[model samples]
Target: MTMQHPAFAKGHVAVVTGAASGIGLAAAREFARLGLCVVLADLEGDRLEAACQEVRALAAGGEADVVAIATDVSRPDQVESLERAVIQRFGRVHILMNNAGIQPGSSLFGPQANWDSVLAVNLMGVIYGTRTFGPNMMSHKDPALIINTGSKQGITTPPGDPAYNVSKAGVKAFTEALQHELRNTQGCRVTAHLLIPGFVYTALTANGRTEKPAGAWTPEQTVEFMMRSIERGDFYILCPDNDVDRATDERRIAWAAGDIIENRPPLSRWHPDHADAARDFIAKRD
Candidate 1:
């Protein structure tokens, strides 16, 4: 599919973290197919190398235009090294996808290590990638992008996994602030986008399931929706899955915010007192 965004132009450079699998791999594949010099950054291993080869096969310029850098985005030093390596190889980067994340099932009183790892990879990773690469991308004077992957749980602040919710919420807030800064920076052509995926059938979401659930979307479908949103100049690329549509997502988010506005109990949708009201509000139309 041809991309309409100037940032996706042929021969441009795109760096996608977590490119070894799922949405990151899907985005890298699309970029390579569009003739962009694609850099796949992930942990050092055979899986990363294999993903690089898959992207390379679809690259318009073949192997030369596709490279994989062993990177642990959670480490600031490693993320910095990734930026330097990409710059040295490609000279300039037109797209940066800070898409590395992890959700190892967190509880309110879970091991602190779980919280630490989740925040390190899901939130700080995005900050490191954007801050490390933003200046270089702006200096090139070309339309560029920084896409941060977030989650719906962040918006709604659901129960069951507090650490993952907190991490993704930080991503959403950080990406918003980053975009505001980019738009206000003089002579800067780079833009930031928040990609909120819903029920994507990835290794991160599979939870040992061999087959995708009926309600989940494939990584390719989510990436395709993200590209379309970017082409339309949307900052919040909120995606829908087989079980939900845009309208449902909107209502759910609104109900979440209304908890504060109406002075209701937190997560009132799940609270027995407000359950009927929440259901009716979501089912109602304007």
Candidate 2:
């Protein structure tokens, strides 16, 4: 399905980080289909080239434009290079998607490298993308958008990878502040949005799976939901999986916040004392 945005017309440029795979790649294809010039950026050079070729092939008979750039989103220099490349090719960027992320499984008190790597890509990458392209979009009078990919793990604080959770949590908070500031900024046409995806089957979670799991959605499905959210001018593009719904997500987030609100022990959901309570809460909410 095509994304229906009045502001996103032919000749508009879109920059998507992590475009080599998953939601970023899906979004890139969608943007290209909508006649937007798409710049696909990723650290994997071969995959980035292949993804760009796919986009170009899809746009062969259309007016859509596509390009690929190898970039390490964790580094400011690489992000800057991507920005310059887009400006040189498309003149200006209309959509900036900070979607590059990595999940390094680690406990709360585990190795520091896990925390550093996850934060660098998931959190710092979003900050760099916004800092690099946001100002340019602000200078233009045309409408622009910034989409940051966050995860439900960040909001609900599930007990698996604390590094990934913290990084995505930072993304959620940062995107919120970005939207607030952008709306208040004088003459700023660029708008910020937070993309919260449910369980999506992608390379990040492939693990040699031949087909998508029953509870997980494909990247394309997630992007379709995201597009609908964008058309509705939603700030928090919270997605729902086949096994989960909006009500479930809301209750999970509320429960997480309650841990702090009620001054419960850390990770109350995993606490032996609160295990039964958490299970009952989830079951009742579901």
Q: Mind giving the per-residue lDDT tens digits that candidate 1 earns over 1-286?
A: 6459999999999999999999999999999988899999999999899999999999977889999999999999999999988889989999999999988888999799999999999999999999999998989899999999999998999889999999999999999999999999999999999999999999999989999999999999999999999998999999999999999999999999999999999999999999999999998889
* TM-score, candidate number 1: 0.98
Worst 10 residues of 1 by lDDT: 1-10
lDDT by residue (tens digit), candidate 2, 39-75: 8999866888889988887763343488888889999
Off by over 4 Å in 2: 1-3, 60-64
lDDT of 1: 0.95
Pairs clashing within candidate 1: none
Note the Cα lDDT for every prediction shown.
0.95, 0.88
lDDT value, residue 106 of candidate 2: 80
Q: Per-candidate TM vs. native?
A: 0.98, 0.94
lDDT of 1 at 15: 98
